[model samples]
Target: MGNSSFFFFVFCFIFLLVLGTCDCLSDQEKDRIDQLPGQPSNVDFEQYSGYVTVNEEAGRALFYWLTESPANRDPKSRPLLLWLNGGPGCSSVAYGAAEEIGPLHINSDGRTLFSNPYSWNKLANLLFLESPAGVGYSYSNTTSDLYTFGDAKTAEDSYAFLVNWFERFPQYKHRDFYISGESYAGHYVPQLSQLIYERNKGVKNPVINFKGFMVGNAVTDDYNDYVGTFEYWWTHGLISDSTYKSLQKTCEGSSSEHPPVECIRALNTAEMEQGRIDPYSIYTRPCSYTTSLKRRGRYPWMRGAYDPCTENYSNQYFNLPEVQKAFHANITKLSYPWQTCSDIVGGYWTDSPLSMLPIYKELIAAGLRVWVFSGDTDSVVPLTATRYSIDALNLSTIANWYPWYDNGKVGGWSQIYDGLTFVTVTGAGHEVPLHRPRQAFILFRSFLENKAMERSSISI
Candidate 1:
């Protein structure tokens, strides 16, 4: 063959080979997902985990894990559910994804994962985020970001993360999206949802496709929360009469985080009276895996999960080098290990509003779906607290309170209102899914469907 003809043939051959290689990989493969260190073999869903830069100037990024529903639903049709854990400093990747609502649970050995049959991913495309640049695998190059975090900054950063994240995937740009969280997320979810709702107005068509939001055992109104909490403690026989009276007298109008000296003393007395009985769950046994409580000069408290041992296991699993590498996390190799909650952020949280009810009202007025749920056994942010906060909204009742069932037994009680809904899981604690996975899943499905909780459903 002539030299020119041979050279052209070789160039064509190289071009075809490169094109074929690109065609072989699907979008899921193109996106980063190194197989989990020890994932279950039978898993059939696609999973992606990585960082999205929310602020390039400050080197702040948020880590996220997205799990497509196992039912093999089309990504276009399935709604997106973004879940945040409270604490204002907690790792949603660790607690929400690994321990509670994600598709898998860490094995007791902390080296393997097992299927979570009642995972929320079965209902939608679930996303778990470690937010605010200091929690879990998310971080900031600027050290001040760790200690100067609060509601406004967290909400803003999370919204920016969403905008950048949609760019990364692109497929889910206009997909129906919902935000949910618990505890301090009572503040996080509502504030972020409000921002999404407002931002949607300025643009012709929002890429976010923002829908509604839900919070479980959330901190809503400070006054109502304090009142309901003190009442719950008294009614549950957790505190003495004098201590309860003292709380009522001293903590009525003061900030719960920084009450007066008399209120602090009363709270201390209440703490002493209640002893080490896991204020979060009230009934579950505390994790015995670590002596860290002794090191901190504090009593260990029960974890919110049904299997209290899972916390320690998850902690161990997340800190593993293989696991971190698989998830593409901890790339900076910081001085400390990955913790479920960040001491830096939690200790230095600067601003918490006296109430999130105003934000909730704005969202509801915008015709957005708002649902608030509570685990009846959670003393920290009990059902009573949620009810009182909702009562402040004065929303009209659409449906009377009724029992919702699963497995032929009452799963929880739910009441529907014109612009909102309230639910209480029968035996759940602060973290509903971790404590009552089956029941939590039922509530989750009904919420997504925009219908009343079913009286009965096939149990997982």
Candidate 2:
């Protein structure tokens, strides 16, 4: 058929190849945010938010918001970090994105957003996901699916979401990936990490490229948490000595998730003794607004900031029709407004292991980077609780306990275990970034670099 025919065939092949690539990218581009409705004008980074259907039969979809590092930072060169907030039913967009590590922070008016100087996106391409189909903007066509949500299914659906999400944002398919979260995500980050690690066992250079995970103020083992919590309350002078003794006697042997009547009574007594303080951030003033919603979960609600009313701002900001439109959320026009946590889902959580210590052992032995951090001021999952959980692991010490500094002041303390690293943010609360953004930023940078927190007083 000669030169003309061969050359024509080659041209057609190349044209189709280019066209197909463009077609694939167009799907991702559709989800891109040209600008958020109330986003700051000086912003010069790309952002995208949308839903990825995880289950077609049940019509379940999970929502995600990606905040890329500024162009000046060369976002393409950064690792991809996925952040989840655990209520077993919380919205990562509300907690992780709006307030904590994401680029935008909601204003008091709840309509406009301001730049977060210490947003995690500056260090990595940050992705916040709301999972389990009943939290925030994520939804299920089959209503019953919400009530049956549990650990195993949540992990499976999240894995599916990642698979489908990669198909849309193929550029990140092979990027270095890490999972992180706080509170109940103590279960999430590790469980998901285990699943990814197990699935990619024999495959070399898998698309997910999951390297490691980190959790802050996480719920680890029930037994350790109970012990540590009661101890913290007693030591901090929050609970009466009698209440502490009762808590130790009644709760040590009981399940933290489903306590017996005696344990519940003890907990109630402890609460009464502690009074009206914000248990999540013991030293901070509680939200004065009477209408502020408290999350009903196995664990207490984890919020960001010294101002306890931050969740109220998120509730107001995310419900705005224009904001939802910009986020490509609420397409189904749900019967309920957006909430920080879903009571139905959290209340109905079906299966949670008594301990995540075993998963930690497995992952650590498998050579994945495992880091655990605690915001010292968080009473919900306090530093004492984290310490107890890590002590249970009995991992060898790589670096002895040492104070880490930022800006010529003690930011926190650190200890490097043989297979895991542990950190404590000095005065941060349940959500470290909200309470201490600069120190949290440094902590994140150290986690990504797999280095110990700075021992020197010099600031980065």
* lDDT (Cα atoms) of all candidates against the true structure: 0.83, 0.87
User: What TM-score does each of the candidates earn?
Assistant: 0.91, 0.93
Which runs of model 2 end up more than 4 angstroms from their true locations? Answer: 1-25, 289-307
Per-model root-mean-square deviation over C-alphas:
3.6, 4.9
User: Model 1, 24-138: lDDT tens per residue?
Assistant: 7654454567589889888888889878889999999888999888756565578999999877677888788988899988998999999998998888999999988898899
Error of 1 at 307 (Å): 10
Q: Which digits, one per residue and each the tens of the lDDT, describe model 2 over residues 1-460?
A: 8899999999999999998887655768889987787888889889998999999999999999999989999998999999999877888998898889999999999999999999999999999999889999999999999899999999999999999999988889889999999988998899999999999999987999999999999989888988888898899998898899888888887766678788878877776787777777888888852343334422332222233677878989999999999999999999999988887888888888889999999999999999999999877788998999999999899899999988789999999999999999998998898999999999999999998999987665
Q: Pairs clashing in candidate 1?
A: 286-302
lDDT for 95 (candidate 1): 80
Off by over 4 Å in 1: 1-31, 202-204, 289-307, 455-460
lDDT of 1: 0.83
Position 32, candidate 2: lDDT: 90
